[model samples]
Target: MTETAHPAVSAEQAGIEQALTDQVVASFDGTPDPRLRQLMQALTRHLHAFIREVRLTEEEWNTAIEFLTAAGHITDDRRQEFILLSDVLGASMQTIAVNNEAVPGAERAATEATVFGPFFVDDAPEIPIGGDIAGGAHGQPCWVEGTVTDTRGNPIPGARIEVWEADDEGFYDVQYTDGRVAGRAHLYSDEEGRYAFWGLTPTPYPIPHDGPVGKMLAATNRSPVRASHLHFMVTAPGLRTLVTHIFVQGDPQIEIGDSVFGVKDSLIKDFDVQHAGTPTPDGRALGGDWARTRFDIVLAPAGA
Candidate 1:
C-alpha cells in the first residue's frame, strides 16, 4: 500500500487575494456575531482589494508601520501626538462634523466644534461675573463679556464655561515647565445666565514642535502654528456640550494658511480693543488704562 502527502493548498502568485482572504476569514470562527462577522468580512475584502489595486510594496507598508509606531511613541500623559496626527490631517474635525448632524434650523448648533488640544487643566475657579481669569501679571487687559444661553434662546443657569488659552508670549500653563496653571479659569454662568471675565486678547500660537507633532510638520514641509483664538468648553444641565474658540479678527497669523485646517468664517470674531480711557464692559476701573474686548457666546440644546 502507498500513501501520498500533498503540500497544503499553497498560495501561488496567481491567487494572492484568495489566499489572503482565506487566511483572514479562517481566523474568525463561523459562529461570531453576524455584525462582527460582516464587518470583518467587509474589511478583509476591501483591504485585500486595496493591496491588489495599489500593488503595494513591502517597503511602503514597512514605512507606514514605522510611522504609526513613531506616532505611538510620541504620545504621553499630557501630550497626545496621535490626536495631533488626526488633527493636522483633519480627521478629528471631520469625525465631529459627521456625528454632529443637527437639525436644519436648530440655531446652527451655536458654533462649530474645533480641536481640543492637549492642555486643559480641570477645576478652574468659579469666580463672580466680570472676574479675571488670566493669571496675574500676564497678557493685556481684555474684558470678555457674554451671555450663555441654550438654543431655545433661554439662559443656562449654572452652566460652566471652562476657559483657557496661551499667554501673550504664546505659552500655556502647562508649557511653562515651571509647574504652573495660569491663564486658565472655570467660570459658571450666574442666575441671569451671563458670564464675564477679564483677560488678555489671545494671540496666534504655535503648537509644541520640539515634540513629535513638530517632527511631523518638518517632515511634511508644513507649519506648526494655529490661528489666534481663545478656547472655551461650555457645559450646562440638559444642554448640548460645546467646544469652540473665538478667532481674533484681523490676525495676520490666521490667514487661509492655518496649518491645521481649523479656521472657519463663523468662528472668527472681533477683538475690538478699547484703548486706555474707554469705558469697560461694566464701567469698572480700567486698571492702568489698559485694553478691553468682548465676546458673546450662544449655545445649542442637547436635543438640538
Candidate 2:
C-alpha cells in the first residue's frame, strides 16, 4: 500500500497569508473615511513588509509568543513590565513627542509633560501643603519651590503639583525596607502660583533588571538606567498639563547617553548646595543650612 501526498507546510503558510491580506482589503474596500482608510492601509503594508523582511520562521515566531507570555507573567498591580519594555525601546518618548509637541511660544498654556515611569504608587499618603516629603529623614535637604505660569505669562493659582523622587540611595520610599510610602507628595499651588516642597536631590539610578527588559538590555550591552531626577506633573483645569522631570545637572547620565533617553536641556537644572544660614520650613531643622533650587514652570492653553 502507498500513501497519498500531503500539502507542504510552506504552501500552507503562503496560502494563509494571502487569504489574510485579501480579507483585510475586502473589509476596508468601500470605506469612505479618508483618514481611517489611510491608517488601515499603512498598517497593513508595514506589518506585511515586516513579516517578509524578518523571514520569521515558525520557531522564531513561537519564541516571540513565549516572550510575550513571560512579559505578562511579570506584570501585576505594582509593576508593568510591558511599559518598561517600551521605555527601553524609546517608543514611549516618541509617542509623547508626536502627541504633546511643544509649539514654540505656544507650548500649551499648561505645564510640560514627561514619561510616567513605572514607579508611581497609587494612593500616596496625603500630607500638609508644606510638609517634608523627605519623611523626617535627610539626604541633600533641598527646598524646591516654584511657580506655575501660563503661556501669556500669568500665574495659575490652585494648580496641583504631584512630585516623587528617589532618595540619595537611588531607591524610592516604596522600595524602602520599612515598606512605607512617603517620598511622594501632592501639593496645591497657593495664590500667586507658589508651590514649595521639602525633599532631597534624587540620585541617578538603574531601571529594574529582574525581567525580560533586563535581558534585552544585556543582550544589546546597553545600560538600563536614568539620570537623577524628580518626577512631577503640574496640572490645572483648562490648561495643558506637563508631565516632566527636573534633572540634576551634575549627573553625567543626563548627557547624550541617558539610558532612558529622557534628558532635555530645558529640563536640566543645577541643584547647588546653599551653606549660608537659611531657616528650614516650619517644624523642621536644617542642621546648619540646606540646599535649594528654584524651578519655575509655565503652562499653555489646552488646545495650544
Candidate 3:
C-alpha cells in the first residue's frame, strides 16, 4: 500500500508566522525600563514559540483565556487563584529556587527556601513566644520550637517569625466564611534567638480544588495534594528574608510528590508523637496526645 502524501506548508505561510513573532518581540524595544523591555521581549518570544510548537488551535486559545478569566473572577483578598495556578504549575518553586540559590563554600549554609502558598495573611495575630498559633483551629496540638541565627551562628534576637498551616480538616482559617484567623500567627524571637509556639501538627492536605487551577490539574492528571508541612517566614534586619516549610519526616506524599514542589530533604524534621498523659512543655492541660518538633533556622546575609 502507498502512503498518502500530505500537503507541505508554503514558504510564505512560515515566513508570516516568524514575522509575527519578530514584530511582537520588537514592539517592546521602546519600553522605558531596560529590564521591562528585556522581560517583555523574552516573554513574547517564548510565548509565541510555545503557540507555534503546539500548533495551538483557536478554540484551545479561547479555552485558555476563559480559564484565566475564571481564575481572576474567583480571586479575592482571601483567595489567590493566580498564586495557586503558579504553584501547581511549578513556576512558584522555580522562581524560589532561582532567587534563593545557595552560596558556595560559605562558612554556614542557610536554610533552604520554598514556595510560599496562597494562604498567608499579612496581619496574622501576634503571639507571645511559646504562645498558641492554632487560634481555635482543630487538630492535634503540637509544640514547635526553633531558633533564629545568622549563617555564622550568631543569634538573631527579635527576628519576626510568621507561622501558618492548615488544620486537620485540610482547610485554612481563611477558607472559612466566618472571619476566623486560626492556624496562623507571628511572634518574635527571644534574646536567645529562641522561639516556640503551639500549633496544629502538620497533615497532608489537598490544595483548594474548586477553581480554574483545580480544573486544570484534573485535566492534566495531576494530584493537588501537598505533603504535610508547616509554613515559616522569618525576617530580621540585614538578613535575607526566608520563606520555607518544615515537612513531616516520612510523609508519604514526599515520595509521591508535593503538588507545589515545595519539599526539601533538609527541611523535613521529625514530628515526635507524645503519648497520652505526656507532660506538656508549658504545663497546658490536654485530654489526649500531642506532638513536638524543632526547627532551627539559619539566615543568610542580605548582601549574600
For candidate 2, the TM-score is 0.83
Candidate 2's C-alpha runs over 4 A off are 1-22, 25-44, 104-111, 136-138, 176-179, 276-284
Estimate, for each residue in 48-84, the C-alpha lDDT of model 2 and write its tens digit. Answer: 6566556678998898788788889989866788988
User: What C-alpha lDDT does candidate 3 achieve relative to the native structure?
Assistant: 0.91
Judged by lDDT, which candidate is best? Answer: 3
lDDT of each: 0.74, 0.75, 0.91
Candidate number with the higher TM-score (2 or 3): 3
Question: What lDDT tens digits, residue by residue, belong to model 1 across residues 1-304?
Answer: 0111123423465365566566786666584598888778777767766666566789989977887887787777767777787888887778767755564675534767777777777776666778787776377777787788765667778888898888988888877767676788887888888878887788877887876667778998998888887889988877778887788889887764676677777888887766677777677776555654455666766766
Q: Name the regions of candidate 3 deviating beyond 4 angstroms.
A: 1-11
Writing each residue's lDDT as its tens digit, candidate 3 over 44-132 gives 87787777767789999999999999999999998999999999888999999888978677678999999999999998999999899
> Candidate 2 or 3, higher lDDT?
3
- Candidate 1: Cα lDDT at 9: 25
Model 1 residue pairs with clashes: 240-302
For model 1, the local distance difference test gives 0.74
